[model samples]
Target: MPERVSRQLVYLVYGGKVEYHQEAKYSILSALHHAQGACPRILLYTDEPAQFIGWPVDVITLDDQILRAWTGPATYLHRRKAAAIRDALQYAEQSIFIDTDTFFLASPVKLFERLAKAPWLVDEIEGVWKEYEGDELHTVLAPYLAEQHGIDQRMLLINSGVLGFQGDASQLMDETLNLIDIMHPMVPKIHIIEQFAVSVAARHLGRPAESRGVIKHYFSGKNYWRHMVAAFFLRHGESFSAQAIEAVREVPTDKPRPVWWHRLNFRLRSVFLSSRMRSHAKLAYYATVLCADPYAKACGQGYAQELRRKAIPEGESLSIQPWSRVLTRQQKQRLAKLLGESATGHIP
Candidate 1:
C-alpha cells in the first residue's frame, strides 16, 4: 500500500430532486469502490439528510436559512460551493471536493498526493482567457476581467468539478468568494462565474494539478449517466449494504459512445436537415435505436420532451415537415411512441 495520507472528502447536495440525490449516492459509491487501502474521511453537506440515511459518511444538515446565507446577498447560488468546501477545513487539515456528477477512474489517493505537494487541484484546465476573446461569454466580460483583474493569456479557466486544497486555504476561499460576489452581478445570467473565480484564486495560491485522468466528470452527458446510475440502483437496492458496495464495481465509469461508422451514418442521414432539426433527430435516434433498455428509453422520452419544447412554440401545432423529411415511417412510429403521441402527424 502507498503511504497513508490523512484527508477529508467533501460533497454538497441540496434539494430533493431524485436525480441529484441519486447522482450523489452513486458518486459516493464510486469513491468507496476505488479507494484502494486507506480511505479519506467522507463528509456530505446536504439539505436533505434523509436521502443518505444508510450511507457510511458524516452528514452535515443545512437549513434553508444557512443555504440562503451561503449564496450570499448576491443570490449567486454557486458561491455556496466555495463556502461549503471552506467549512470542511474544520474537519480535516486537507480537503477535496468533487461534484456529484462524477465517477472515479482511479483511486483518489493520487489526487491527495498532488494536493499535498501543489496545494491546488482543479478538474481540468478549460483554456486561457485570450482563446475565447470573441465568444458570447468572453466578448462582454473578457475585457473587464482583463483590464480590471489582469486576466491575460496565461490566466486559465478551470472546471470546478473537482477541487482540492489544504485547510490553510481559508484566504484562498475568501478571495474566491469575493470574486464570485463581484463578478456575478456583471453577468447575472451566466453560469460559469463561480468556476472562473476559483481559477483566479487557485492561480494566486499555487500551480494547479488537474485530476482528469483519475476522475471522470459527466456533466455534459448527465442524462445518459443518470439512466445508467438509476439502473444500478434498480438492479440492487438504494439502501447501503455490502452487496450494493460490491455491485457498484459492475457499473461502467463512462457512457458508451457510438462507433465511428455509426456516427458517420447518422451524420449522412441528417445532412439535409436544418441544424435545429438535426439536433432533434439525434435525440430521436438515441431514444429509439441506440439502446434497447427501458432506462435508455426513458432518457429518450426526456429528449423528446426537450425537442418538443424547442421545436413547437407554445399554443402552436407541432411541425411535422422537419421530422417527416428526416425520419422513416418506422423510426417516426418509435419516436411517436416515446413522445406518447400517435404516429400519424404528432412527431416533433
Candidate 2:
C-alpha cells in the first residue's frame, strides 16, 4: 500500500463584531469546500468565541489586550487577526493566513506548492506607496523599524491580506511581530499596518535563501470586488444580496465552475446596487439584510427608520439597471422580489 501524503494546514484569523459572524463563517467554509483536496486542516482564530458556530476544526480565542498590543484601532478587528497569526506559529508545520473578506475562487494549494518551490508569498495592493506623500510615514517608521526591529524603509510596504509561510519558520514570525510593534506606535494609518509589517520584514530579513526562501507578491485589479460578492452568497445564501442570488441561479450547473474572480464581480454588483442611495426602499431592504442581527439591534429601530423618509414615490420607475438584465430571468425575479419587499417596508 502507498503511504498517504500529509496535507498542509491553513489558518484564517478574524476579529470583528458578531454581526459579521455569518459572513466570516461562510467565507472560511467556502474556501474549505472549494479547496477540499488541497488543505488538510483549517483553523480559525478570533477574539469573541460566541460569534462562531460549533465546528470540528480548531478554534483559539485571545484577549483584547494582546490584540491591541499588535495592532491598534486603525485596523479595527483586523488588528486581532495579525495577532492570531503570531499565536498560530506554535502549531502546524505550514499555514496560510487569509482575511475573512477574501473568498477562494479555486484551490490555492498550488499557490503554496509554488511558494514552497520559491521563497515567500504575499499580496501587494495597487498603488500602495504612491499614496504616501514623500516617505514621511515610511521614513518616520523606518528608524524605529531598524533601530528597534532591524527592518529597512524599502521593505515596509507589503500587504498582509494573504501570507504563506513555512510552519517551522518561527524566526519570520518573530521578525514580523517585532516590526508590527515598532511600526504601530509611529504609524496611525490602520489600513497599512499589516502590509507595512511584512514589507519591512521582507526587506530586513532579506529574501529567504533559495534554501531559505523567495517571496512572490500577488496583485489583482479592481476585479477583486467580484470575489467579495461570491463570498457573500456562499455565506448569507439568499438573504444578503439579491444580485448574488440571481447570478448563482443563472449559472449553468453543468458548465465548468466559475472562477473565483468572476464570482467576485457578481458580489461587487450587489455592493453597487446597495449604494444607489436614491432607492430609499432598496436601500432599507439591503441595510436590513446586510446589517445582520445584533448590529441592527444595536443601532435600535432608528437604524433604518429613515429609509422610508425619502422613498421614491409609488409607480415612479428608478433608472437603475434591473437585476434581471444583469442576470438570468430566475435570478432577476428573486432579486426583484427582495428589492420590492424592502421598498414596501416589509423587510424589518
212-253, model 1: which lDDT tens digit per residue? 788889989776678778877888878987777677777756
Most lDDT-accurate candidate: 1
Q: Show model 1 residue runs off by greater than 4 Å.
A: 1-5, 135-151, 257-276, 292-306, 309-319, 325-328, 342-348
Query: What tens digits encode model 2's per-residue C-alpha lDDT throughout 1-348?
Result: 111233333344444643245435544554555565354566666666555545435666657666666564444444455566666655656666665544455455655675576456554433333356466675565455457655432342456666666435567667656656556667666456665666655553334212112211212311222333334444446243334323433321121223466445456655545445424433333333332332222221232333333443554332243322234444334334433644543211
Minimum summed lDDT over a 10-residue window in model 1 is located at 312-321
Model 2 local distance difference test score: 0.47
In model 2, which regions exceed 4 Å deviation?
1-19, 54-56, 63-78, 125-136, 142-156, 204-348
Q: TM-scores of the models, in the given order? A: 0.85, 0.54
